[model samples]
Target: MARVSQAHLDARRRQILDGARRCFTRNGFHATSMQDVFKETGLSSGAVYRYFRGKNELIRAVAEEAFDRMRLAFESAGREAPLRPLDEVIDGVLTRALEEQARRAGTDRPGAFAELILQVWSETLRDESLAATLHALYDRMRVMWVVVVRTYQDAGHLRADVPADHVVRVLMALIQGFIVQRAVFKDVGGELSSGLRALLSPEADPHYRG
Candidate 1:
């Protein structure tokens, strides 16, 4: 038997993941069959097993991919953004996530990290491992929020005595609350965004401008 190179193996794995995600999004987790992934990939069941042992394993892989992608999104945002104040950093990230989610709100993008997140939360009773992956991702995102908090603290925008880790927890909770509310309602107060901006803005804005 000819040995597959690492690059070749990685490419084939990516291909299988892509097809599996499409099927999951189209048919939903419960509805999508292993055969659906096989059909999507045009690979036999045995060949698919070579990449992923089962559908659950595939879901875990997809979850890992989703987290890695989101992390990349934040890293890209950090590089491209103008370094002005801390609030801009937070808004930049939240805006990206919100926009991406809004795009997938109604669709059957089961492969979407956001959709997978909801499914994992709803189905955790039956899928512990998937739920663990999601919990880990959420915890990692909190670290990003903590960095923003420390940035503001360093800029003298927030009280120096305030704890960065504590602030991150508060911010994460705030964002999560908004997401839950937005799911049920059409409009959340724009004032919330304006308030966040004000919180990060220099209090002596008028005097500093002069």
Candidate 2:
């Protein structure tokens, strides 16, 4: 018997994960089964199970991979020397997310990634471990936002009086709302960057007296 190289093992694991993502995206979490994954990947039950104990573990792994990418996007944006404008940074991150989704789904549909996210969010309600994983990932992303908020405050771009955490919460809410809208409606007309600019800019809204 020949031993498998680490690269071979890694590729096999990725193949299983990619197949699982396709299954989950196509039929959703509850609808997809280990058998579906096996059929999709054309791998034996033993081969798939060797990498993942069960469907729940596979689901968790898939969700973690997606969220970790998001976390890394924010982490990279936060580290820029002269950080890009908030709206541009957000737009870039969203673009990257959609691109990744398109690559995974083998289509350029705008909501493919968003729909997968909705499924994960629904699954979290039933899976405590999944919920914890997502919560931790979100917390790390929120910290990145906090760092952004403080950076802007120090640079006099955002109001110094506003709590950083509060701003971070609103930012997260805006992104979440965008995802939900995109997933459900499939056409979220109007530019998110423009909306962010308007909301963040004191002079962009004339009717306000803040």
Provide the overall lDDT of each model, using Cα atoms, as 2-decimal numbers. Answer: 0.66, 0.84
Most lDDT-accurate candidate: 2
**Count of backbone clashes, every candidate in sequence:** 1, 0
Summarize candidate 1's per-residue lDDT along 15-48 as a digit string, tens digits: 7988876676556788988988998889899989
lDDT, model 2, position 175 = 89
True-structure lDDT of candidate 1: 0.66
TM-score of each: 0.72, 0.92
> What digit string (tens of lDDT, one per residue) describes model 2 on residues 1-210?
999999999999999999998888788888999999999999999999999999999999999998898788777877762367777777678867866865786567758788889889999999999999999999989977798888877776666677999998998899888889888998874578888987877556465344
Error in Å for residue 38 of model 2: 1.1
lDDT of 2 at 110: 55
TM-score of 1: 0.72
Clashes of 2: 0
